[model samples]
Target: MAERDDLSRGLWAVVRAMWSEIGPAGKAVLVALAMSAVVALVLGVAIPKQVERHLIDAEIRKLSRIVGAMADAGVIPTGPAQADELNALDEAVRLNLLGSDTVRVKVWLVDGTILYSDEPALVGAKYSLSEERIDAFNGINSVDIPNLSLRENEFERGFPPLRELYVPVADDSGSIEAVFEVYHLAEPIETTVGNIQQLVWASISVGIGSLAIFTASLILVYGRSIANRRRLAEKLFGELVRSQAEERTRIIGSLHDDIGQTLYRIHYGIEDLRSRVDADNPVAGELAHIGELVNEVDGSLRAELRSLQYGTGEELALGSALDELAEVTEMETNLSVSVHVETDCELSPPTRIALYRAAREAMTNVRKHSLATTVEVRVQRQGDQVRLQVLDDGVGIIDDEGLGLTTTRERLEAIGGGLKVKPDRRGGTQFSAWVPASECEVET
Candidate 1:
């Protein structure tokens, strides 16, 4: 049972993968082809059988009519016959019934005696009547392909498969007197059935071929439309990115020119006032403290400006960006930071941005939560994927992620990348992020 469940899940996963890979038009074509194949198979088997049955039924009816005409004309033998009577009966049988397709004929008495037969040696032979022959004595007409393996059918074995039919000959009182057994060639009916089946199969083939052509045309058109849409979306997304970068640059410039210069002037003014004041004056000490506060605020503002520049600027490589982040992190916290990045492939703008954000978020988490100091950041392109790892010698576990890390994770996931945080084997927290390195272009 477990194996069966696993097999079912495996098949389902394959189907889901196929479903995702094929677009809507391809899926429609696949379903149409499958349904058409089933239909053609059913008709291919069933139509031939139905046609053969109809042809055989017609042959049986014709045989019955021929036997009935002989009975009506008093040609069939009713009992034991003299030599002259047998000769007359044989003449009548040959003149009226014998043909290429009508190979043999026999008249049977109630006691299973061959009262009359075209085969001379079987004129007086006796055989046990089967249940079907007995039923014919009660006026039931039957038709079948005789099995030549039976002892009674030894003479007929030399012939090809023949249709065996039984027709009851009745007297004036409507009581059956003898049974007429007929053997007719089956080649005509078989030929007719074969021709009909060929025609049916040919028609099915043409229909399927036409459907395939139509489906191919539809797929081509749909594929072209999809490609066009993708190109348009990429163009729009590139424009949007450029516009956002320009807006961010504008904001950074405004803040630097307006707020930054004003704060700098305020700090300089405070320092000059402190220089002119008496050294032992209490007010001078207070002015010095105020200048220090202003300087700290200016430093924080400059750090924020650098961050904004990093996001908007396009000149820095991914490795350089991570190195700059590490330096800033080391400066702010009492931690030693090491960086290693080995990648030869160029990265897309979005991938570069996402990886940089992941590193920054991981560093922020380390600063806020982890206790120990030293940190190491590593980046490398492994096969098709580019991986980033930030290891800290701090505490090994984090109970929860802050909103910054969560947002970074979502951003990475949006670009077919992922982020994971776990405990390192060497007693530190490990932050890992990865994106497909082969996907060097943005996708809609």
Candidate 2:
């Protein structure tokens, strides 16, 4: 029973998968084939029976015509006939109808009296009639397989199966005068039915086979087209990512080379001028403050530049990069920041960069929007995914996310990762991000 259940489930899964992958046209074709197969099966079984019925009907009509002709020729007696007359009737029946196929014949009166039969013993005998035989008196013809077990059919006992046909004989006034009954060997009719069934089944099989091949070909063509389109889309996405990375690297290089050095020189010039002035001079005080401001700006710029270079440099480990982010956030804002690295697995460069960006974005939001006094950054590997969580003790949950965070989420999702932000249990907001570790693992 368990194995049967498993097999049913497996079949259901395959059907579901196919349903999801195929288009409307493919589904329609499958439905049509299913309906056609059902119809074909029904016809395959029913047509053979109809053919046998028609064959029996043809035999009854032939026998009825022969009997009617004999009556018209004055070969049948209306009342009880003499021994000579009976002999003449029997010979006529044997010559006209009795053969290998037509095994028996009986002429009967409306009162259930057998007038003449090829078997001499049944001549002028009376027997009780069944409804089917009585129906012949009303001009209704029928065919059936006779029951040889009955007393009336004792002579036909041990005989092969036979088809019994009944025909009503009419006089000159269109009145049924007598009933003619004929029995034919069933083997010939059965053989004919078998041959016809073979032909019908063969035709049906050919049609179904052709339809199946057409449907399969259509599905194959459709599947290949979908696969090709998917491959093209993936290629385009990869190229777009590479181009963006290159552009970002170029911008980082320009900032570090030109703006960073210029800022450094301005800070030193201010410091030198302040040192040369008198200590009591108000001008020296202002110059000292300006130098302090320039130094702060330079420090902030250098920190951001380092963060931008994390994945591009030789040191692409996320653990160290996250620690640096915590330090910078703590220095820039008076927030107490902590870092926890709970996993040792190396992440690929893209994963490292995505995680770093998520962390940085969360910290920036915390500093700008949250009136938080403390923050915690944690990284861990769970199953096949690496997760990053940044929690800040701040004003409860915020409903709207900034544009930077939205972009960060898209970037993470592009690499089979996702981002979430919710209210932390510690009375602050928690920013969480996860990426598939299997796909983002560094090669050994």
Candidate 3:
């Protein structure tokens, strides 16, 4: 259960880290871009067809009106509007609409005769609108079918394609009069629509390409930024460890050169004094007893001296050493401190120094300024690095005016360690340091 919980926590942490990198700005942009793309797809593909159909309808109605006017004025048909007049109107319609090579317009009688046609040879031909033959026809209409005949005023292309219109003319009686035909070059409209489609596709492709590149760029920038920060952090940890090791070595050397020699001299003098004393005279008896006591005192002193292991300069065992330093410091300064140090692995000298100095600096700050009664030093090792924390339940820092922190920071930095002041999770200023073991291991 514990392992599972740890794994779940780790996965969630990774997810949170990823979310932090992408952020809200990126998500909003992606959503807006997606909506825009949907709109573009609809507009680019759908609008042109609608426009073309509307244009064709309008042109067809106008054709019917023009032809109807001619018929009403006795310009076409027999009786009041005779066949000669009808022929004249037909010729006029032909001349006007079919004059252009690109346009083919024709008029057909209900009997399927090509009454008027733009193509001369096709005039008077039989008309058969098998393509658009319908159950019922609208007044003014346009459709697309297959091959169109100019003479019969009938046209064909395809469904919603090259459009042709057939408009029916009506007299005062509202009777079906004649059919008027209008021609439109749908290829141009289709071509224009095609061009628009190509442009839209191109634009969409470019937009998607750009979006992909931009997204990739953002991810890359964040990734590199995080990587650089991690590198800097690691380097700091290494330096702290190395600096701590160096400080420990220096302190050990100091102990050996100063206190060690003093203890050695004291031991030898005690030995000589004991040898000189005899058991004969009364004064000698008293001196002999004092000399024996002195020998016991010398042995105790020698035992105390052994604590340093003369010039051993061995890496300090993490937990015990921190407790010892705290104990000695409390005795000297009258400051009450609780040291909580634990470690699972052996520590290098540099890492130990970094942790110790960081704690010492915090203690010094407490002693000089905090005037607090309780101080805490905690050190723990996790995996490859050691983390140390120092906290004081003293008066909070007064506007951060102290050099101990700066000096401690410098010392830790010298060996690639990190020092930072954070609001103690428990309500105080906490100084924390971390150093890597690899950096702390000094050459013997």
Candidate 4:
């Protein structure tokens, strides 16, 4: 945790140092999508329109060639004969139109009268009475219809979109004889463009969806990894705290039990030696007893320090820490004391020491300042947390500057713990500390 915070702070400091700014991720996504849409539109519209234009132009040229071929061969009879006399042009038109689904060919005489047409009515009657037919009849070999807005001949048909090319075919005597025109329906080209657009959009959508899924997965994975690291760090810190407490307890026990006992033995030997040598060595015996008394006092001090810091690094049963506190308060103070512990989760060594200190401070304050008769303690495990309380039926400290209570709060917070103190329901004060159960467990 310490390293992570430091790294993060340094990186952010560098970013701030550079005065760099970043756009929002949402805007970036939108811009990327919009660019994709533009590309899709180009592919969908431009390519197909170019293809349809090439195909329509080719049809027009082919129709012109067949009409010229018939005019060259004189296969179209000079005057009306059997319908079969038109066979050469008819055959040419049918063959060319058959090869293309888009082309429709028709033939009309010089008077705007249809001679033969793919449409039955045009074969015998006048055409649409449009200027397209008039121009073709007046020796215009190539009269292309302009689009609707130009106040000119309609470019193509109504429902199917229209494009027409009129080619005049002259007789041997040079009189205008007929017009051969090819019509192309634009609707199919438009429909083809629409399909292309749908396909392009589908591809772009799929690509974006894939990118989103991949990015989301990456973020989720990183978040989960960070969470696991935090949990492990907390666990390690708990273990380190418990280990330090255990080591301290071991050292204190050694000074009190082993070193103190050896010193006492040497003191007794010296006292006996002095008594034997100088007879009536009252001071010597007295000095030996004083030395023993000093050792005893030292032992008591060792025990007190051990109680504050001792541990086996195991989960410390709540009853044990509270029992010791209750005993000390009852024996030293006039206040009647009671302690109750109901918990299934035990606290680790550091937490136990913290709780013991808090409870001890509260009771000590009660003894020194509170003119109260009764003190009550309750420790309970609520869900994942262990809660400890010390209450006194005495005059309670009103100010926040009370040294002991302030220290208790600070200690709890140091371990990611919580502490609170309030007036008891019956009269006096209540002090409480709560910490997580996982922190209490040593190896387990």
lDDT top scorer: 2
Clashing pairs in 1: none
User: What CA root-mean-square deviation does each model show from the true structure?
Assistant: 10.2, 10.1, 13.2, 17.8
Candidate 2 residue-wise lDDT, 36-143, digit = tens: 999999999999989987888888878888888888878888768888888788788888989879888888888889988887788878988878789998889998
Q: Indicate the TM-score of model 1.
A: 0.57
Worst 10 residues of 2 by lDDT: 435-444
User: 296 in model 3: Cα distance from truth in Å?
Assistant: 37
Q: Give the whole-model CA lDDT for all candidates, comma-separated.
A: 0.79, 0.80, 0.60, 0.63
Report the number of backbone clashes for model 3: 25
- For residue 77, give model 1's deviation from the true position in Å: 5.9
**lDDT tens digits, residues 1-444, model 1?**
977887785665555434433456777787988898899989989999999887777776776787778778777777998888788878877886778788888888999998988988888999999777899999998877887887667789888879888888888898888998888888888888899999999999898888888876776677566545544544554566678788888989998999999998999899889889999999998998988898899988888888788743355788888788878777777989999996655777766766877888888888888897899999986644689999999877678777888888877765556899999999989999987554332111
lDDT of 2 at 443: 21
What is candidate 4's CA lDDT for residue 382? Answer: 58
Residue range with the least summed lDDT across 10 consecutive positions in model 3: 131-140
Across 134-195, the per-residue lDDT of candidate 4 in tens digits comes to: 77777764535445553222323343556667777777676777777666665565577668
Best by TM-score: 1
Q: In model 1, what is the error at residue 327, expressed in angstroms?
A: 15
| Cα deviation of 429, candidate 2, in Å | 28
Question: What TM-score number comes out for model 4?
Answer: 0.39
- lDDT for model 1, please: 0.79
